[model samples]
Target: MLEQYVRKILTARVYDVAEETPLQSAYQLSQRLGNSILLKREDLQPVFSFKIRGAYNKIAQLSEAEKARGVVTASAGNHAQGVALAAKHLGIKATIVMPKTTPEIKVKAVRARGARVVLHGDAFPESLAHSLRLVEEKGFVYIHPYDDPDVIAGQGTVAMEILRQHQGALHAVFVPCGGGGLIAGVAAYIKYVRPEIKVIGVEPEDSNCLQAAMAAGERVSLPQVGLFADGVAVSQIGEHTFAVCRDYVDEVITVSSDEICAAMKDIYDDTRSITEPSGALAVAGIKKYVARSAIKDQNLVAIDSGANVNFDRLRHVAERAELGEQREAIIAVTIPENPGSFKRFCEAIGKRQITEFNYRFHSKEQAHIFVGVQTHPELDPRSELLKQLDEAGFPVIDLTENELAKLHIRHMVGGHNDAVINERLYRFEFPERPGALFNFLNKLGGHWNISMFHYRNHGAAEGRVLAALQVPDDEMHLVPEAFNSIGYPYWDETDNPAYKLFLAQ
Candidate 1:
């Protein structure tokens, strides 16, 4: 049935789109899983996604009278670009309705494709309703992004290419699920050709409409959708696509946002390609299922569905990648307030490298310190570190699991000091080479006490250092010259905007 529909659409459309994408083998993933792993590179398509195939096919199949009436669509990101580009290629006027909060980059890309972009509502459903209203009022053809027969048929071309490229060696195929168009098409074709090959559907655990619908044995709407994987953040699967998925897909898996970030990094490290969180879903699901089922020495294929990620989000992905692997720990340790107590606490930590340290001398009797430590994989080093501190007669609290400690305490340390003393904060920029920070610490005059300091080597040529010092009120003016003479650029907190903001809070 799907093949017949695909043939009909191919015959109706004058444009050719079959020769663009490639099916590439993933060497790193295959070795890691002990299986022959292949990647269907729909990400390499002209629009950087498989959505174009379906969008173009659907629009091409319209009757001549319908084509003259123009087109309208509602999409969050990738699909919007697909529709806009397809309309431009076919010489059809298209109006795309997108959420107001859609990324600026996506909105610009849609406009660049010669489509009139309308920012409406706060979510896809609301924008979709608005688009439908425009279709009715202007007599425009509403091009359903995923629910039509032509769209599903066009998407099935991915499966056809996969079969030709891999030659039936696949034991399982993983596809990310949003509104289920891509998965529905792929599963229908793969099941028809290779009934033994398992068809797995993947979804973000936070917005898992397909998984929930399959469990209930019927379509169900999600109460809320997660925007982290914005490309696949669908609240409900389409009726036509869900019908194909219900009959063809063998299993469905849900992956967390952290897991998706890890997968995105993995793909970048292996293939040097940046994939959006949605594109990484298939790879994440395959890795998760292989570990869960202990499947070894089998063939696997993961469809890299799209690569339309915003570059600004990469920083957040990099920050959370290590935590996903359990290779780092953030904790708070309290030590004695006496002289040499800090040295003893450092000694107790032994061989662990301190990634971050923030502290304040609270009272004459106690000091609070927040520290982040690098730990061996597969072990909670916090318990052992705490035990050693306790044995050394220091009161230690494990703030490893404290959300507040992880988010805020590390950055705001010096505010807890006594008001009797005068403290000055300075921002210092210095070279990032080894021991540069230590050298700055060593140059501090003995009379001036170090109150608080925070520095991180961000893999840049230069490093930023924020330090607070407690000194006699008369010595405050001399501190800037002290840093300047040492060839370090420094800014006093009195005139720093960040300090004013923090003080205001």
Candidate 2:
């Protein structure tokens, strides 16, 4: 089985459209991990993903009659781009059926390559079904994204390049897994050539089709997959790909969404390049493996699979990266409502940089504060911080691992307080800088009671804040004048429907 794949991979005609992307050294990651870390830069391919290698290889090998009939496939994004570009190169009319939920940028990318784009149902399964129907109706060949033997052989070229590029000591190669195509191809080639070097597959925990299959000893479909790592959000492993992976692959590692984000940041820090969440899976797995096995001084390679992530998604990635790395701790601490109590709590926290702070005056006796503090996994761990706060007589609830607290509670800490009467909500945008919030608050003059406040720093040029001030109906006209004096751009959100539903009285 492996011999056949090895032969096909050796003669795979992927270079026609895909580049032999460099296996670049991850210098920073190497130093930190105490191992020589190499990144297989598949993100540098023509389609910005390794999917092109298989897509082009399969399409190019078709008979003249099949080429004339054209080809069709379904993809959420990355594979669609690869098929579109490969067909255009061969002068074949290609039709790509993509989920309606696919990003417009990807839809445009496919169309840009002169492929007809059919925006179908809400997800890949739906679109895939539609593409198969097109295959039967139009007599066009359907290019399977991962299941085909030729496609698997095409992806095997990645492992071929890795072995040739670094003919030195290599402990393992981490491949990101979706439908098992890349891992299947990579594992087959590596085991046949360098059996000593481990072939490990990395997957998102919530979307781990390959890992699930390995456990089941057969292909198994997940009820649903998380869309965070959308590129690898496959529900089932490909049948052909799984057959190779089940035997050839040594191990499969799963990483969480937060870990994936941290790996993305780590890759960016080393290479100054951004990769999609799925692209960073191998690195995340490497981190988990190293931490678990306590391995050191070995050569490990991680496949930086693709860079098709949307720019807007970076904000969420940035926010979660710290928490994923165990570098940030979120806690809800109860402090006395006395004037100097907040100051005393700050003194207790001591020297640590506060990433965020949210407080509300729920009662006259005590206040619940949601705070984010910088922590290190080794030096100043969350346990130590909790100990210190406890020693200082501050009752704290560690919300670091609380999903509800991190996702929604942090933002909705002080919402719709009946006691916060005569409240007028205003959203403010100020230049982000040290003491900017302090200055803004100082300018407010402390005339009216600040009933509610919400602020989160997103590492942006501008700092946005949502705050409500208690102002009588008669004094409402003076609110805009006071904001004008503050000189920050402000919006009246008191009447905003979202505010009314969630935060307003």
Instruction: Give the lowest summed-lDDT range of ten residues in model 2.
Output: 496-505
- Cα lDDT of model 1 by residue, 34-69, tens digit: 777778888888788988988888888889999999
Model 2 bad stretches (over 4 Å): 415-505
Q: Rate the local accuracy (lDDT) of all candidates.
A: 0.76, 0.87
Q: Please give the distance, in angstroms, between residue 196's alpha carbon in candidate 1 and its true position after superposition.
A: 1.0
Count of backbone clashes, every candidate in sequence: 0, 0
Can you give the lDDT of residue 360 in candidate 2? 64
Model 2 per-residue lDDT tens digits across residues 136-176: 89999999989999999999999999999999999999999
Candidate closest to the true structure, highest TM-score = 2
